[model samples]
Target chain A: MTASPDQIVVRDALKTYGTGAAEVTALAHVDLTVDRGQFVSIIGPSGCGKSTLLRLVAGLETADSGDVTVFGADPDQACAAKMIGFVPQVPALLPWLSVEGNVTLPSKVNRRADALRRTLPGHVHREPADPRALLTKIGLGDSLARLPHQLSGGMQQRVAIARAFAIQADVLLMDEPFSALDEFTREAIQVQLLELWEQMRTTVVFVTHSVSEAVVLSDKVVVMSARPGRIDAVIDIDLPRPRRQGLLESAAVHDYEDLIRGRLQTAWAAGPATR
Target chain B: MTDTTDTDQTGAAPTGATPTGAAVADTALATAATAAAASVRRRQPSRSLLRPTIWLPAVGALIVAGVLWEIVAINNTYLLPRLGMIGQAIVTQPSFYLENAGVTLSEALVGLVIGFVAAVLVAVLVTESGILRRAIMPLAVVLNVTPVVAIAPALVVAFGFGPAPKLIVTALITFFPILMNVITGLNSVSPPILQVFATLRASRFEVLTRLRLPSSLTFVFAALKVVFPLSIVGAVVAEFSAPGAAKGLGTVISVASSNSRLAVVYAAILCLAIMGSVLLFLVTLLEKRVLRWHESQRLLRG
Candidate 1:
């Protein structure tokens, strides 16, 4: 059994889109490592390839060069093992499926993943959480039978969150999941997500543009610069565990947010000169 | 049902029913009354259907059209048959028209079923591979552009003077719309949802059955709406162009018109029109029931 503490490793990963003059580099020699059970958030400007980085880790795309590994295996293998869970910006729930059916969807289709996971030495397999109980925990108990369209935007996002959590995946990748929601709904769901994360302690790599969100949820916040995306800084948030919305008022949290913002400004300034 | 509506009217009275002395009792009573009224309203399915306001214009127009038709027939009996004479012809030998109507209806239905199943299966296969799609789609388009009426006589020559030519011609006419619509539907799954399925390692069958098929339903229903009425047209056209031993409304209309039996011709045409309308209504009803979860369906309900 391999005993690496790091659950995810991205080394010198480079990805580009298009070709010829129109070709643009999405990620340029980006490197990141996420420790087991760590909550890491990747935050940057719109074109910083934060989503590209998340997609790489989700095995949804291949890097032009370098490597991405989860649980000592390649991203595709880990994904095949049902070890990667994704929550996209949109809820992306099946329109015909009820909230319960949407939550239970991963479990139903993961037969191939299950068999792959069994072959890995020292891989601990827990029975997936009951989708109903997870839905209730996420405050969707009453909407169990409702289709995705029937739920409000926030409620639909919560169901999406519940679905990702239900698989008990070793790695959860979220791409700006709360960006579409209103301010109040976003904050409420952020707290709910933290609570869920505390229980699971699965390695998470969340991509977002919100600085406060990154500071609140992540153990390590990865700030990337745009124009050929590269990691500009990695800031460790020393906030106490069981983080709540109440902590947003504290000075320490504000300091971390400011520090990240300052670093981001520097990264942004560092770009145009090269262009 | 009467008692419920009665209670609803009384319960919805403008605040005067509340007792002055007991405010708490008044609140509770008001709440119960509102709940009862709401439930009663829900139990009465589509009150708009029964409303005179909704039906008055439609009924009035039909009545006016009927009177105008009768007046026209009185002036020109050869060209425009009186409504009574057409009705009399149908009443005198109802079984003859009924039998022919049944044949046309059955042919349309059987052809529609065959067309629908074949289109769906082929669409599913086509969606699976670009190679098959490229190879087959042009052929389908070519077939669609060729008038099935023109092909009906050749079909009769090829398949003999039986029901086969009529069924084939009908199936050919209805196939393209459904195939095109279902193909579009199957490919319409959102990228994020497709990625979710990919991450789950969902098999091709799973993706097709659970995601693609359900996603395709709204499109399928849209196509069926057009195709249902068209299926009847296809059968009639086939019957007209390729008449053999079979007796359909198309054949009846043609035979009556040649003999200048304008009443029987119009009567046969009336049967065809009614059959088309009833088929279209059934498709709409099925769509409403099946696509209840769809956004278009929900908006329609409102």
Candidate 2:
């Protein structure tokens, strides 16, 4: 019953915004752990602290009371080691930098992390992906010299994806990365994301509001409830490998969707009635 | 619904089309127009200077203003010198005008460079330290509000009637705007992008170089546009306060007007105007090169 060496463990983490009178709890007594290389999605209503959870894991926010650890180290330590790559909901590319420049930014800034990675034991030896090649693979080769403002929302998001992948991080924290796209574009990107994830086997903690999206991509769907946010349920998705659009139309997929949807409804009802 | 579809198919491309069909057609039309416009834009080889809307109106306006000035001068020679008279004055002793203009331009250029570097350094410091920003910004505002004219005489007395006082004046006039604009531009990076940098464990220096400094170029250039003219004005004012034989354009104008050499004064003023325009044009050219990817630049192209 030994814990996995590469696991992320969050134990009774609590976060609140503002001083006493204006205080609003973001995450209350939230406890979760994600195994290495697993794709996990957290789905809930708007105030359910999914994003807060992700941020805490990324070391962007600290818990008020509890401990959050990544690979036996604190979140900040893990972040400093370049073990965490965060993709926010927005594309967040530097507007002044060309697409290629933005994608290579992490590699340029993370020299210390590279040295640490080289010394770490049991880490696989791999050459970092070329920024231009990655962009071309994601259909942005021609746009290498273009700035972020010159790109569409979808293309900008793709650049963000390329940037995250280029960081060569162990765990990628994505907070609703596909939420801004149209449905068709979102589906296309989800597939592309899946393919990318499958190729790299990077652990992912994705936050989203879509039930179908959660069921489609995650190895486990973690449902949360609002009003001092906490996890309500964790549903395991036992679908086959290399999941595709065709699998989305199958009855088995519908059953998983129904199960998650039913759990989500209860989680939603359990929250404060006002919301 | 079936009958409507049949009628829609059989009839002349229906005038009042179905929503879906109309939307599809609209999308196609918009895409085609965008592609055509893009192609047309690509075919042109940096023709922004040749565009009628850009330079034509400016040249035409200048000609019209000159003609009106000449007509007004013909009636009132005591106050306004005729264009011909100014031209004659400029032609008679070109060396005097050239030497004076050269002195002013050199002062402005040197002061501008010093002010620009100092402002950028101070902006970086202020942006890095909240305490310093709070402490310095209020004092900057106070200095900014003090009239340059009021300070020119004090500067002249302190630094004497040489180019030193004029250089100080020009630097002082240009520094504030650059500082303000640089701070604003550095702070304007999206929070999400900052988070991205943070997640990568980027050092403060790395963030400044890779993100903030590059992003601030447009704002710095925008500030330069204001500083360019003010630099000239500050240099001129400082020149006006100069004692003997300083020989800047401002000195030329002052001497000419006092001696009732109206045409010489007009000639100096014309030189000043041309210098300001040339400096502005050069700054604009630099801005276009640096901020080629900026949205404002793209909008200008269109």
RMSD of each: 6.6, 6.8
Docking class of 1: acceptable
TM-scores of the models, in the given order?
A: 0.91, 0.90
- For model 2, the stretches where C-alpha displacement exceeds 4 angstroms are A1-4, A118-126, B1-39, B42-60
Give the TM-score of chain A, superposed on the true chain A, for all candidates in the order listed: 0.96, 0.94
lDDT of 2 by residue, A68-98 (tens): 8876667777777788889999989887788
In candidate 1, residue B18 scores what lDDT? 23
Task: Write down the worst ten-residue block by lDDT for model 1 chain A.
Answer: A1-10
For candidate 1, the per-residue lDDT at B24 reads 20
- Residue B290 deviation, candidate 1, in Å? 1.1
- Model 1, range B53-97, lDDT digits (tens) per residue? 667889999999999999999999899999999999999999999
